[model samples]
Target: MTTRDTVHELLRRIGESDPEGVAELFAEQSDWRFSWPDEGHPSVPWIRPRASRADVAEHFGALGAHHAPERNRTTVTRILVDGDDAVVLGTIAQTVKINDVSYTSPFALHLTVEGGLITRYHIYEDSLTVARALSGDTGPDRRVP
Candidate 1:
Protein backbone atom coordinates (compact mmCIF):
# COMPACT_ATOMS: atom_id res chain seq x y z
CA MET A 1 0.00 0.00 0.00
CA THR A 2 1.12 3.54 -0.58
CA THR A 3 2.25 5.56 2.38
CA ARG A 4 -0.87 7.69 2.32
CA ASP A 5 -3.11 4.67 2.08
CA THR A 6 -1.33 3.00 4.95
CA VAL A 7 -1.55 6.04 7.18
CA HIS A 8 -5.19 6.61 6.38
CA GLU A 9 -6.01 3.02 7.21
CA LEU A 10 -4.08 3.17 10.44
CA LEU A 11 -5.73 6.36 11.56
CA ARG A 12 -9.14 5.00 10.66
CA ARG A 13 -8.46 1.88 12.70
CA ILE A 14 -7.45 3.88 15.74
CA GLY A 15 -10.50 6.13 15.55
CA GLU A 16 -12.56 3.01 15.37
CA SER A 17 -10.89 1.87 18.60
CA ASP A 18 -9.81 -1.37 16.96
CA PRO A 19 -6.63 -2.17 18.79
CA GLU A 20 -6.22 -5.38 16.87
CA GLY A 21 -6.25 -3.54 13.56
CA VAL A 22 -3.92 -0.89 14.84
CA ALA A 23 -1.45 -3.51 16.03
CA GLU A 24 -1.55 -5.24 12.68
CA LEU A 25 -0.36 -2.04 11.00
CA PHE A 26 2.89 -1.98 12.95
CA ALA A 27 6.02 -3.97 12.35
CA GLU A 28 6.96 -6.69 14.81
CA GLN A 29 9.84 -4.69 16.30
CA SER A 30 8.88 -1.21 15.24
CA ASP A 31 10.23 1.74 17.19
CA TRP A 32 7.42 3.84 18.63
CA ARG A 33 7.71 7.08 20.54
CA PHE A 34 4.67 8.52 22.30
CA SER A 35 5.09 11.74 24.23
CA TRP A 36 2.60 13.52 26.44
CA PRO A 37 4.32 16.60 27.81
CA ASP A 38 4.63 17.07 31.56
CA GLU A 39 0.91 17.39 32.02
CA GLY A 40 1.43 16.74 35.73
CA HIS A 41 -0.50 13.56 35.23
CA PRO A 42 1.30 10.33 36.10
CA SER A 43 0.95 9.26 32.47
CA VAL A 44 2.87 12.15 31.07
CA PRO A 45 6.14 11.89 29.14
CA TRP A 46 5.26 8.32 28.23
CA ILE A 47 8.14 7.85 25.87
CA ARG A 48 8.67 4.47 24.19
CA PRO A 49 11.63 4.63 21.85
CA ARG A 50 11.38 1.02 20.76
CA ALA A 51 7.94 -0.27 21.52
CA SER A 52 7.35 -3.83 20.41
CA ARG A 53 4.01 -5.37 19.46
CA ALA A 54 3.57 -6.52 23.02
CA ASP A 55 4.17 -2.98 24.22
CA VAL A 56 1.63 -1.65 21.78
CA ALA A 57 -0.93 -4.16 23.01
CA GLU A 58 -0.30 -3.19 26.59
CA HIS A 59 -0.54 0.49 25.76
CA PHE A 60 -3.92 0.15 24.10
CA GLY A 61 -5.17 -2.19 26.80
CA ALA A 62 -4.16 0.26 29.50
CA LEU A 63 -6.05 2.98 27.65
CA GLY A 64 -9.14 0.81 27.63
CA ALA A 65 -8.74 0.15 31.31
CA HIS A 66 -8.28 3.77 32.22
CA HIS A 67 -11.19 4.99 30.12
CA ALA A 68 -13.15 2.81 27.81
CA PRO A 69 -11.80 3.50 24.34
CA GLU A 70 -15.29 3.28 22.88
CA ARG A 71 -16.32 6.27 24.95
CA ASN A 72 -13.58 8.56 23.66
CA ARG A 73 -14.61 9.83 20.27
CA THR A 74 -11.70 10.48 17.91
CA THR A 75 -12.46 12.99 15.18
CA VAL A 76 -9.88 13.57 12.51
CA THR A 77 -9.54 17.08 11.27
CA ARG A 78 -6.74 16.51 8.80
CA ILE A 79 -4.08 14.05 7.70
CA LEU A 80 -0.95 14.79 5.67
CA VAL A 81 1.22 12.11 4.21
CA ASP A 82 4.58 12.20 2.42
CA GLY A 83 6.60 9.12 1.51
CA ASP A 84 6.89 6.98 4.62
CA ASP A 85 5.89 9.80 6.97
CA ALA A 86 2.52 11.21 7.83
CA VAL A 87 0.93 13.54 10.33
CA VAL A 88 -2.57 13.11 11.71
CA LEU A 89 -4.32 15.91 13.50
CA GLY A 90 -7.32 14.82 15.49
CA THR A 91 -9.35 15.50 18.56
CA ILE A 92 -10.44 13.15 21.29
CA ALA A 93 -13.44 13.89 23.45
CA GLN A 94 -13.28 11.58 26.42
CA THR A 95 -15.49 11.07 29.41
CA VAL A 96 -13.47 9.73 32.30
CA LYS A 97 -14.82 9.14 35.76
CA ILE A 98 -12.18 9.90 38.33
CA ASN A 99 -12.85 9.60 42.06
CA ASP A 100 -16.57 9.37 41.33
CA VAL A 101 -16.43 12.65 39.44
CA SER A 102 -16.85 12.64 35.69
CA TYR A 103 -14.13 14.47 33.79
CA THR A 104 -14.41 15.34 30.17
CA SER A 105 -11.25 16.33 28.34
CA PRO A 106 -10.76 17.38 24.73
CA PHE A 107 -7.33 16.57 23.34
CA ALA A 108 -5.43 16.36 20.09
CA LEU A 109 -2.81 13.95 18.77
CA HIS A 110 -0.18 14.36 16.09
CA LEU A 111 0.97 10.98 14.85
CA THR A 112 3.84 10.16 12.55
CA VAL A 113 3.93 6.87 10.75
CA GLU A 114 6.93 5.30 9.05
CA GLY A 115 7.29 2.15 6.97
CA GLY A 116 3.56 1.71 7.30
CA LEU A 117 3.92 1.70 11.08
CA ILE A 118 3.46 4.36 13.69
CA THR A 119 6.79 5.78 14.82
CA ARG A 120 5.82 8.76 16.94
CA TYR A 121 2.76 10.15 18.70
CA HIS A 122 2.74 13.60 20.24
CA ILE A 123 -0.13 14.99 22.25
CA TYR A 124 -1.27 18.62 22.17
CA GLU A 125 -3.60 19.71 24.92
CA ASP A 126 -3.89 22.01 27.87
CA SER A 127 -1.64 20.48 30.53
CA LEU A 128 -3.38 22.11 33.43
CA THR A 129 -6.71 20.92 32.15
CA VAL A 130 -5.52 17.35 32.03
CA ALA A 131 -3.82 17.56 35.40
CA ARG A 132 -6.91 18.96 37.04
CA ALA A 133 -9.16 16.41 35.41
CA LEU A 134 -6.97 13.54 36.43
CA SER A 135 -6.59 14.87 39.96
CA GLY A 136 -10.27 15.71 40.29
CA ASP A 137 -9.47 19.34 41.00
CA THR A 138 -12.25 21.89 40.77
CA GLY A 139 -10.55 25.19 41.55
CA PRO A 140 -10.77 26.78 38.14
CA ASP A 141 -8.38 24.04 36.95
CA ARG A 142 -5.45 26.37 37.58
CA ARG A 143 -2.75 24.32 39.33
CA VAL A 144 -1.14 21.46 37.49
CA PRO A 145 -1.76 19.12 40.40
Candidate 2:
Protein backbone atom coordinates (compact mmCIF):
# COMPACT_ATOMS: atom_id res chain seq x y z
CA MET A 1 0.00 0.00 0.00
CA THR A 2 1.02 3.60 -0.48
CA THR A 3 2.36 5.45 2.54
CA ARG A 4 -0.80 7.57 2.81
CA ASP A 5 -3.01 4.54 2.57
CA THR A 6 -0.98 2.68 5.16
CA VAL A 7 -1.09 5.61 7.56
CA HIS A 8 -4.83 6.14 7.30
CA GLU A 9 -5.47 2.45 7.71
CA LEU A 10 -3.39 2.40 10.87
CA LEU A 11 -5.41 5.29 12.27
CA ARG A 12 -8.60 3.60 11.19
CA ARG A 13 -7.58 0.59 13.25
CA ILE A 14 -7.33 2.80 16.32
CA GLY A 15 -10.77 4.26 15.66
CA GLU A 16 -12.12 0.75 15.28
CA SER A 17 -10.73 -0.27 18.66
CA ASP A 18 -8.31 -2.70 17.08
CA PRO A 19 -5.15 -2.05 19.01
CA GLU A 20 -3.48 -5.23 17.78
CA GLY A 21 -3.91 -4.15 14.20
CA VAL A 22 -2.64 -0.71 15.03
CA ALA A 23 0.48 -2.24 16.49
CA GLU A 24 1.00 -4.46 13.52
CA LEU A 25 0.85 -1.47 11.18
CA PHE A 26 4.00 0.00 12.62
CA ALA A 27 7.55 -1.00 11.83
CA GLU A 28 9.37 -2.82 14.58
CA GLN A 29 11.73 0.09 15.15
CA SER A 30 9.36 2.86 14.17
CA ASP A 31 9.81 6.18 15.93
CA TRP A 32 6.33 7.18 16.98
CA ARG A 33 5.49 10.54 18.54
CA PHE A 34 2.08 11.93 19.38
CA SER A 35 1.67 15.60 20.20
CA TRP A 36 -1.09 18.03 21.08
CA PRO A 37 -1.18 21.78 21.53
CA ASP A 38 -0.05 22.45 25.06
CA GLU A 39 -1.06 25.70 26.72
CA GLY A 40 -2.14 25.30 30.34
CA HIS A 41 -4.35 23.19 32.58
CA PRO A 42 -1.69 21.14 34.30
CA SER A 43 -4.20 18.64 35.60
CA VAL A 44 -5.32 17.64 32.11
CA PRO A 45 -2.92 19.05 29.56
CA TRP A 46 -2.59 18.05 25.91
CA ILE A 47 -0.47 14.94 25.17
CA ARG A 48 2.82 15.03 23.29
CA PRO A 49 5.51 12.40 23.49
CA ARG A 50 7.94 10.40 21.39
CA ALA A 51 7.59 6.72 22.08
CA SER A 52 8.88 3.32 21.12
CA ARG A 53 6.54 0.65 19.76
CA ALA A 54 5.99 -0.69 23.25
CA ASP A 55 5.44 2.79 24.58
CA VAL A 56 2.86 3.49 21.89
CA ALA A 57 1.16 0.23 22.74
CA GLU A 58 0.98 1.22 26.39
CA HIS A 59 -0.32 4.67 25.50
CA PHE A 60 -3.27 3.41 23.47
CA GLY A 61 -3.89 0.63 25.93
CA ALA A 62 -4.26 3.13 28.74
CA LEU A 63 -6.64 5.22 26.69
CA GLY A 64 -8.74 2.18 25.87
CA ALA A 65 -8.85 1.19 29.48
CA HIS A 66 -9.86 4.69 30.56
CA HIS A 67 -12.35 5.48 27.83
CA ALA A 68 -13.98 2.08 27.84
CA PRO A 69 -17.48 3.43 27.57
CA GLU A 70 -16.75 5.75 24.67
CA ARG A 71 -16.59 4.55 21.11
CA ASN A 72 -14.41 6.65 18.80
CA ARG A 73 -15.69 7.99 15.52
CA THR A 74 -12.90 9.31 13.33
CA THR A 75 -13.13 10.94 9.93
CA VAL A 76 -10.23 11.87 7.71
CA THR A 77 -10.28 15.44 6.48
CA ARG A 78 -7.06 15.41 4.46
CA ILE A 79 -4.04 13.24 3.65
CA LEU A 80 -0.66 14.34 2.32
CA VAL A 81 2.13 12.04 1.21
CA ASP A 82 5.67 12.64 0.03
CA GLY A 83 8.01 9.72 -0.58
CA ASP A 84 7.97 7.54 2.56
CA ASP A 85 6.37 10.24 4.68
CA ALA A 86 2.69 11.10 4.97
CA VAL A 87 0.42 13.26 7.09
CA VAL A 88 -3.22 12.80 7.88
CA LEU A 89 -5.52 15.52 9.12
CA GLY A 90 -8.65 14.20 10.71
CA THR A 91 -11.34 14.61 13.34
CA ILE A 92 -11.95 12.42 16.37
CA ALA A 93 -15.34 12.57 18.02
CA GLN A 94 -15.94 10.49 21.10
CA THR A 95 -17.74 10.49 24.39
CA VAL A 96 -15.42 9.80 27.31
CA LYS A 97 -16.18 8.86 30.89
CA ILE A 98 -14.89 11.15 33.59
CA ASN A 99 -16.35 10.82 37.09
CA ASP A 100 -19.40 9.05 35.69
CA VAL A 101 -19.97 11.91 33.22
CA SER A 102 -19.67 11.63 29.45
CA TYR A 103 -17.53 14.22 27.65
CA THR A 104 -16.89 14.75 23.98
CA SER A 105 -13.91 16.43 22.37
CA PRO A 106 -13.77 17.30 18.68
CA PHE A 107 -10.15 16.71 17.73
CA ALA A 108 -7.70 16.44 14.87
CA LEU A 109 -4.71 14.20 14.16
CA HIS A 110 -1.43 15.04 12.41
CA LEU A 111 0.29 11.81 11.45
CA THR A 112 3.66 11.04 9.95
CA VAL A 113 4.11 7.76 8.15
CA GLU A 114 7.41 6.27 7.10
CA GLY A 115 8.51 2.91 5.75
CA GLY A 116 4.86 2.05 5.16
CA LEU A 117 4.20 2.54 8.87
CA ILE A 118 3.33 5.34 11.21
CA THR A 119 6.28 7.26 12.64
CA ARG A 120 4.72 10.21 14.40
CA TYR A 121 1.27 11.43 15.28
CA HIS A 122 0.16 14.74 16.75
CA ILE A 123 -3.23 15.75 18.07
CA TYR A 124 -5.11 19.06 17.78
CA GLU A 125 -8.32 19.75 19.56
CA ASP A 126 -10.50 22.15 21.50
CA SER A 127 -8.68 21.85 24.82
CA LEU A 128 -10.86 24.39 26.59
CA THR A 129 -13.90 22.53 25.45
CA VAL A 130 -12.44 19.26 26.73
CA ALA A 131 -11.53 20.79 30.08
CA ARG A 132 -14.94 22.31 30.59
CA ALA A 133 -16.68 19.13 29.64
CA LEU A 134 -14.49 17.08 31.93
CA SER A 135 -14.99 19.52 34.80
CA GLY A 136 -18.77 19.55 34.29
CA ASP A 137 -18.47 23.33 34.09
CA THR A 138 -20.31 23.77 30.79
CA GLY A 139 -18.34 25.44 28.02
CA PRO A 140 -18.88 29.00 26.90
CA ASP A 141 -20.80 28.10 23.75
CA ARG A 142 -20.82 24.32 23.69
CA ARG A 143 -22.90 22.90 26.47
CA VAL A 144 -21.64 19.81 28.31
CA PRO A 145 -24.27 17.25 29.03
Candidate 3:
Protein backbone atom coordinates (compact mmCIF):
# COMPACT_ATOMS: atom_id res chain seq x y z
CA MET A 1 0.00 0.00 0.00
CA THR A 2 1.05 3.58 -0.57
CA THR A 3 2.05 5.82 2.31
CA ARG A 4 -1.23 7.68 2.13
CA ASP A 5 -3.18 4.47 2.17
CA THR A 6 -1.20 3.26 5.17
CA VAL A 7 -1.95 6.47 7.03
CA HIS A 8 -5.65 6.22 6.29
CA GLU A 9 -5.60 2.65 7.52
CA LEU A 10 -3.86 3.79 10.69
CA LEU A 11 -6.63 6.32 11.24
CA ARG A 12 -9.18 3.61 10.70
CA ARG A 13 -7.49 1.44 13.31
CA ILE A 14 -7.43 4.33 15.74
CA GLY A 15 -11.13 4.94 15.19
CA GLU A 16 -11.72 1.30 15.88
CA SER A 17 -9.78 1.62 19.20
CA ASP A 18 -7.37 -1.05 18.01
CA PRO A 19 -3.95 -0.31 19.43
CA GLU A 20 -2.45 -3.52 18.10
CA GLY A 21 -3.73 -2.75 14.63
CA VAL A 22 -2.18 0.69 14.78
CA ALA A 23 1.15 -0.70 15.94
CA GLU A 24 1.22 -3.06 12.95
CA LEU A 25 1.51 -0.05 10.65
CA PHE A 26 4.70 1.24 12.21
CA ALA A 27 8.30 0.12 11.90
CA GLU A 28 9.93 -1.64 14.81
CA GLN A 29 12.11 1.36 15.62
CA SER A 30 9.78 4.15 14.61
CA ASP A 31 10.03 7.54 16.27
CA TRP A 32 6.91 9.13 17.69
CA ARG A 33 6.76 12.62 19.08
CA PHE A 34 3.92 14.62 20.50
CA SER A 35 4.92 18.30 20.42
CA TRP A 36 3.65 19.45 23.79
CA PRO A 37 5.90 21.60 25.89
CA ASP A 38 7.03 20.46 29.31
CA GLU A 39 5.80 23.56 31.18
CA GLY A 40 2.75 25.87 31.47
CA HIS A 41 0.65 23.06 32.97
CA PRO A 42 1.40 19.74 34.56
CA SER A 43 3.01 17.61 31.90
CA VAL A 44 0.93 14.75 30.64
CA PRO A 45 3.00 11.78 31.74
CA TRP A 46 2.26 9.81 28.58
CA ILE A 47 2.77 12.56 26.04
CA ARG A 48 6.50 12.30 25.85
CA PRO A 49 8.76 11.39 22.92
CA ARG A 50 8.84 7.69 22.19
CA ALA A 51 10.76 5.28 20.04
CA SER A 52 10.14 1.66 19.10
CA ARG A 53 6.88 -0.19 18.59
CA ALA A 54 6.70 -1.12 22.26
CA ASP A 55 6.98 2.51 23.29
CA VAL A 56 4.20 3.41 20.89
CA ALA A 57 2.02 0.68 22.31
CA GLU A 58 2.70 1.93 25.82
CA HIS A 59 1.79 5.45 24.77
CA PHE A 60 -1.57 4.30 23.53
CA GLY A 61 -1.99 2.19 26.64
CA ALA A 62 -1.48 5.23 28.82
CA LEU A 63 -4.05 7.15 26.82
CA GLY A 64 -6.50 4.30 27.11
CA ALA A 65 -5.98 4.23 30.85
CA HIS A 66 -6.70 7.94 31.20
CA HIS A 67 -9.41 8.60 28.62
CA ALA A 68 -12.63 7.01 27.53
CA PRO A 69 -11.76 5.69 24.08
CA GLU A 70 -15.36 5.28 23.04
CA ARG A 71 -15.98 8.95 23.79
CA ASN A 72 -12.98 10.11 21.78
CA ARG A 73 -12.91 10.76 18.07
CA THR A 74 -10.50 12.27 15.58
CA THR A 75 -11.94 13.72 12.42
CA VAL A 76 -9.54 14.25 9.62
CA THR A 77 -10.25 17.37 7.58
CA ARG A 78 -7.42 17.25 5.09
CA ILE A 79 -4.48 15.20 3.94
CA LEU A 80 -1.44 16.20 1.93
CA VAL A 81 1.01 13.68 0.63
CA ASP A 82 4.38 13.94 -1.07
CA GLY A 83 6.21 10.73 -1.70
CA ASP A 84 6.61 8.90 1.60
CA ASP A 85 5.64 11.89 3.76
CA ALA A 86 2.11 12.88 4.58
CA VAL A 87 0.43 15.49 6.72
CA VAL A 88 -3.02 15.12 8.22
CA LEU A 89 -5.07 17.98 9.63
CA GLY A 90 -7.83 17.04 11.99
CA THR A 91 -9.66 17.68 15.22
CA ILE A 92 -9.83 15.50 18.31
CA ALA A 93 -12.74 15.36 20.71
CA GLN A 94 -12.28 13.39 23.89
CA THR A 95 -13.77 12.95 27.34
CA VAL A 96 -11.45 12.66 30.29
CA LYS A 97 -12.02 9.50 32.32
CA ILE A 98 -11.61 11.01 35.76
CA ASN A 99 -14.11 13.89 35.54
CA ASP A 100 -15.91 13.12 32.28
CA VAL A 101 -14.84 16.56 31.08
CA SER A 102 -14.90 16.94 27.30
CA TYR A 103 -12.18 18.66 25.30
CA THR A 104 -11.74 19.40 21.61
CA SER A 105 -8.57 20.45 19.86
CA PRO A 106 -7.32 20.94 16.33
CA PHE A 107 -4.35 18.84 15.40
CA ALA A 108 -1.80 18.35 12.66
CA LEU A 109 0.12 15.14 12.26
CA HIS A 110 3.18 14.45 10.15
CA LEU A 111 3.99 10.91 9.18
CA THR A 112 6.77 9.28 7.23
CA VAL A 113 6.25 5.88 5.74
CA GLU A 114 9.03 3.77 4.35
CA GLY A 115 9.04 0.16 3.22
CA GLY A 116 5.30 0.05 3.89
CA LEU A 117 5.92 0.90 7.51
CA ILE A 118 5.60 4.22 9.28
CA THR A 119 8.98 5.41 10.50
CA ARG A 120 8.32 8.85 11.93
CA TYR A 121 5.19 10.21 13.56
CA HIS A 122 4.82 13.71 14.91
CA ILE A 123 1.69 15.41 16.17
CA TYR A 124 0.84 19.01 17.01
CA GLU A 125 -2.22 19.79 19.08
CA ASP A 126 -3.64 22.31 21.52
CA SER A 127 -1.80 21.21 24.62
CA LEU A 128 -3.50 23.74 26.90
CA THR A 129 -6.90 22.24 26.30
CA VAL A 130 -5.54 18.75 26.80
CA ALA A 131 -3.78 19.80 29.98
CA ARG A 132 -6.96 21.35 31.32
CA ALA A 133 -8.98 18.26 30.50
CA LEU A 134 -6.42 15.94 32.04
CA SER A 135 -6.13 18.13 35.15
CA GLY A 136 -9.91 18.34 35.51
CA ASP A 137 -9.81 22.09 35.15
CA THR A 138 -12.90 23.75 33.75
CA GLY A 139 -10.73 26.39 32.13
CA PRO A 140 -11.31 30.13 32.31
CA ASP A 141 -14.91 31.31 32.18
CA ARG A 142 -13.96 33.38 29.15
CA ARG A 143 -11.58 32.92 26.28
CA VAL A 144 -8.09 34.34 26.68
CA PRO A 145 -7.20 37.22 24.46
Candidate RMSDs in Å, in order, are: 4.0, 3.7, 2.5
**lDDT, candidate 2, 1-145, per-residue tens:** 7876887687677877676777777666555433334344443432445366765666666566546435555567777777776656655555555544455555555566666777666666666655564566654776753
Error of 2 at 69 (Å): 5.5
RMSD of 1: 4.0
Q: Tell me, by TM-score, which candidate is best.
A: 3
- Each model's TM-score, in the order given? 0.69, 0.68, 0.89
lDDT of 3 by residue, 35-122 (tens): 6764334536788767888887777777778888888776899999999999999998888888888889899999999999999999
Q: Which scores higher on lDDT, 2 or 3?
A: 3
Error of 1 at 127 (Å): 4.3
Residue 70 miss distance in model 2 (angstroms): 5.7
> For candidate 1, lDDT tens digit of each residue in 46-143?
22333676666666655555555556655677777666666666555554444433344445555556666666555565555555555567566353
Which residue ranges in model 3 land beyond 4 Å of their true spot? 38-43, 139-145
- lDDT for model 3 comes to 0.82
- Local distance difference test, per candidate? 0.58, 0.60, 0.82
Q: Spell out the clash pairs found in candidate 1.
A: none
| Higher-TM-score candidate of 1 and 2 | 1
Instruction: Judge candidate 2 against the unseen true structure and give its global Cα lDDT, from 0 to 1.
Output: 0.60
Steric clash pairs (candidate 2): none
